[model samples]
Target: MSSPTLDDAKRRSTEKLDPERDVETLELAPASEYYVSHPFMRKLLSWGVEARGILPVPREERTDTQYNRIFFIWLSANFNILSFSAGSLGPAVFGLGLRDSCLVILFFNLLASLLPAYLTTWGPRLGLRQMCLSRYSFGFFGVIVPSIFNLASMCGFCILNAILGGQTLASVSGGNLSWSVGIVIVSVVSLFISFCGLKFLSWYERLAWLPVLLVYVVALGIGGKHLINPPPAEPADARTILTFASTIAGFVITYSPLASDFTTYFKPDVPAWKIFWYSYLGLNIPIISVQCLAAAVVVAVPTVPAWSDGYADGNVGGLIQAMLRPAGGFGQFLTVLMALSVTANVAPTLYSFCLSFQVCMPFLAPVPRYVFSVLATAIIVPLSIVGATRFYSTLTDFLGLIGYWASAYAAVVLMEHVIVRKGRFASYDLRYWDSPRKLPTGLAALGACALACALIVPSMDQVWFVGPIAQKTGDIGFELAFAATAVFYVPLRHLELRFRPMV
Candidate 1:
């Protein structure tokens, strides 16, 4: 058969696209080469494809101004409202005595939120995706280590979030509906939204925050009345405060790896200060505020009613209902709003998980990124249905574990870009994944850092060598892991390069 023309190839590729197909197997070399070779043609194609939803904004669309890039980064990072809502558990589990708890949250938020900007800014400047950027640290084929790890983590997160969304739905509907049904419903909805791609996801995220804000206001308005009338208060202690602080730290630090994946889309024109302020204010402040409110509610009403023998079964919804009950019809409206807000929270979580997976498996031949996203959602929904509760329990520990690895990965990247090479490396060099001449020191550093972090993580669970620290400090193992990785890798990298120069 004769080689297919460009138009024929495009037609065949589009025709063969399947939602269930694995994107890792897609054959896109011809298309990729066509765009790479023809500069003017590539710009036209990019606009056309992006317009039709087949392509994302090309690098050329990015503004070179620092402020513009920062704004985009801020929007991307702040868009995920789930981060704050999930983190409410920190104060709930640890209680408010730990004044340091807020500090820990602030520190972790700053680190995870800002450091990734530095790494990802390099990506847009170089015009590469996250996985491709890993080539600098992980080395040609070595990039697969982070890629595979990230893919697994993303899938696991999708399942975990689906499970949470299902549980929340089940709680609101009362025990008449099974948890499995709720999980399935949530999974299907998430899958449908994700299958629609970034455009739909972006619109949903922008609107989702509105209901979340409404729920917060309504819940607080009602809950505040209850606080004024005042039930008996539980005495706060030192241990409680420590745990709370540590938990906040753990929650924030755990999200560091995921930050870069979002901020990579920022226009280069965005300023760093704008990115920093918006992320700190728009993202971190709102999130922490929610957590504080949740903590206050738990404190005010120490005894959470058990529905179906589960603690806090109705606590969240009850808070909303209490607020709505005062409004009568308005209250009912707020209740519905609360439910929708919960579902909206899941949208960004699922969307981000899909994007991370797409980056993780860029080598797929037949399936495209959107298809992989849909497939991921399908897999997550079923898992959530069967194991939603158990999955929820595992999320804290699982994120903690992932946190260690993510911190290690971040440490390696920071050391390489900021200290080791002083940011002198060429970004385009990442595309040459087969280069054998490069030192694999970055991969080695990451491995060593991961091992160190793994060793310390169990301590955070009140299990091993440093159980007392975790028990006393909450699960601030993330801080320990991040500190250890940076300290170890930075010096180790220097020694490795000096002792064994790559000639």
Candidate 2:
């Protein structure tokens, strides 16, 4: 009954550190009294959240009750990602007005959020990374397809978020701070949060909301009057609406692969409906609110120049700055609060990016996750700096490309979960994962994605590629990739299921 000795703990940790196996000792060591008193060592190491990856979290270790955890997840969505300007983007990009913009935001945000909600259910049920879950659809080795997309999307978040963080910091500092300087500061802070692990992230998410939330409500309260007299609506045709709706949907869909990473620690008995509503409401409400508010702000003060490279490019920073400008030092405080909020978003994104890498490449699992986080953020620093120039365009195209793969992937997985797997999964069996013959051959997923991509190609207009049909027909091409994939994959997956025993 005595507590295990320090030596026993060390031995157990060493045993789990075997390089041959895809594992690491994610257990925390007790802080010595000296280190605790000094505080610097713990601060340097990011004292918590460094939990095990891939391995099923033991039942006793699963701590969060459903209700309490939802709010933390709720708070997770309250950041620059859902900031007023970013949310208003759906309609703004297409020249839609406040009313139309809000409507589009609400519709697409709700529609796009469904996949993330459905996927959140798998977290507790499977207790595995989403990429690991991909092995069931894609063979272990074949998982590279989705994994690569996921990794790119996640790293995309880091780069974009870092750029935003840099911009936010630089904006708050008046004219003195540089974007590159801001980028490093944000990246370093994110590295610490991610490197220290999820435990730290949870704590940070729980507490960090206070200042930002206060600032947000206060800004809204003071600026509420400006929304009274909205600017006149902009004209929009069918092509413009569809293009804008799809783009907004693409933005929300970008998070589909990342939904479960935040919820995997919930108790397995947690109801699927709870997971759905919590995650859905948490994301949708704040985003919709922000979009509507920003859309209103865009109308009221159309001439307020956004802070961008040498010009007002209608960036969010300038918009927020303009709103809070009337408030003096209060405005400065809010700017800093919002900048820190961007950093908070960075931590979770970086964590997911590294998880995607670790889960995708089992051989790399021998290296500690923190090392991966460092490498990931390091790569993003430069990309973020370069990409920030065309921020809005980069943001749109990046989200759309990732959205294509994510939408198709989610469609197939949702179909398989409902029709083939029936809201159930085989528990924590890497044998079923590591062996390709033992898993589904990935034909359905690959085919569905390729089909989605094929359709997306014709409908696409971006910095990278502009489809002929897209350029001609307002980019509709009349093909709904997600719907097509969902329809196609169901039958394809059934055929694969019939031969399950042959492996």
Model 2 ranges with Cα > 4 A deviation = 1-51, 303-311, 426-431, 463-479, 498-503
lDDT of 1 by residue, 1-503 (tens): 33333344444432112233111112223333333334554464454321111222234344434333333333333333234334545445444422334454555565555555455445334334555455566664555676666666666666665555555555556566666776677666766665554445555555566665676677667656554443443555654544444444444544445544444445544544555564455455555665555544554554433211333443344444544565677666655555444444454455555544544554342233445656666777776666554542455456556665666677777776777666543323332332435635455576657666654665465323356556665555556666777777776666666754431
CA lDDT, candidate 1, residue 142: 58
lDDT per residue (tens digit) for residues 48-110 in model 2 = 435355543433354567444544654554445335546656555667877777787788788
Give the TM-scores of the predictions, in the order they appear.
Answer: 0.74, 0.84
What candidate 1 gets wrong by more than 4 Å, as runs, is 1-58, 61-87, 95-112, 117-120, 171-177, 228-243, 263-265, 303-333, 342-362, 390-392, 424-442, 454-459, 462-476, 494-503
**Residue 49, candidate 2: how far off, in angstroms?**
4.5
lDDT of 2 at 204: 76
Write down the worst ten-residue block by lDDT for model 1: 15-24
Instruction: Name the candidate that leads on lDDT.
Output: 2
